[model samples]
Target: MGQKIIRFSDLTGTHVENDDDLVRIVVRQHPDLEDGPVEIEALGGELTAVEELALDLVTIELHRPGADEPETVVLEAEAFDRLASATPMAEVLRGAKKVACPIPSQTAVPAGAKERVNYASLEHAGRPHKGRTTDAEKQLVRQHLDRINERLAAEGVRTIDLGNAEHVVRYGLEALARERGVTLG
Candidate 1:
């Protein structure tokens, strides 16, 4: 006898008249509730509405059955618009932001954005011992540059191998760090 249900469209001070499953509730304007479902839960002698909404993300909140509250569920504008339009629920809610972009669009990761620099050749050659540089060491440096070029390919950027490509690696690292919005050690 404590259960209650309400449609998003019937949010206003409307009455269903004879539906026992339905609860009469005052509708509040919410950014998240602009175009979403409205569910009511009976607690003791009182009722509460659970609103599930999406903005950029999915969010849920509880509200007094009919009283307006300040808190709101905000979805990513893109997601909200898409959900509102695609679902029949959209016709139930009052307003919504324009469908600017599709929802669930994957965020693109720039090339070279990897936190670790994989210099397989240098790693295989092992760290230099003392100050004696051998031919193998020079080869290792070339290999490191090759790996860097491979990483740069995904970033859709150009790689410049200066007279000493090894030294230019610092510049490459800096550019990558800046593009990735991170600092390199």
Candidate 2:
């Protein structure tokens, strides 16, 4: 028995806007691979820490004909470090996690009240606010922490009490809005 030596394409400069778009682009480009295999086999994780940077690490395996072997290439979610100064909007929204706000037990939507949409399954348009992963819900938190730390570095505000999940979400959302030049509220 041998471990499957998977061949990966060189995605060195591929710029995927977000996780979902990343998946779509990779699939469309590869044509042979479906979405599930790409996430499970190639990437090695459902979600990665790169999400902290408002980015996703996508592995595209190029199976070029008559080549010695396939090569693995890395694609940043939004920006191409060599050319672009900032990340693309799609990258910022891709695989963005929704900060689950707690709903009161009494106010919780009744079971099967309505068929909810899994925005995660939806495709994003060129415009913002169209995706179900709205700025209010999905905001990159870790990246925001880094930004806040930098701005307050001299002020000695490093000691942040991430007391609760919601607080973290609140902070992350605020930071993302500021960085993207948008308002979550």
lDDT of 1 by residue, 1-185 (tens): 69776533233444444455455554444434422345542232223324433224555443545332223465664565576566655563545455356446534445777442222244433231323233333434443545645555555545434433343353333343354465434
lDDT by residue for model 2 (1-185), tens: 87944344234334333444332222333434322334322222333544665646565556676433345577874343334347655565475576576868855678879543332221211112221233212333333444444544545444222444444453344444455565433
* Candidate 2 segments whose C-alpha is farther than 4 A from its true place: 1-138, 153-160, 171-185
Candidate 1: where is the Cα deviation over 4 Å? 1-142, 164-185
C-alpha lDDT values of all predictions: 0.42, 0.40
What does candidate 2 score on TM?
Answer: 0.19
- Lowest summed lDDT window (length 10), candidate 1: 124-133
Per-residue lDDT, model 2, residue 47, is 34
- Looking at model 2, which ten-residue stretch has the lowest summed lDDT? 122-131
lDDT of 1 at 104: 60
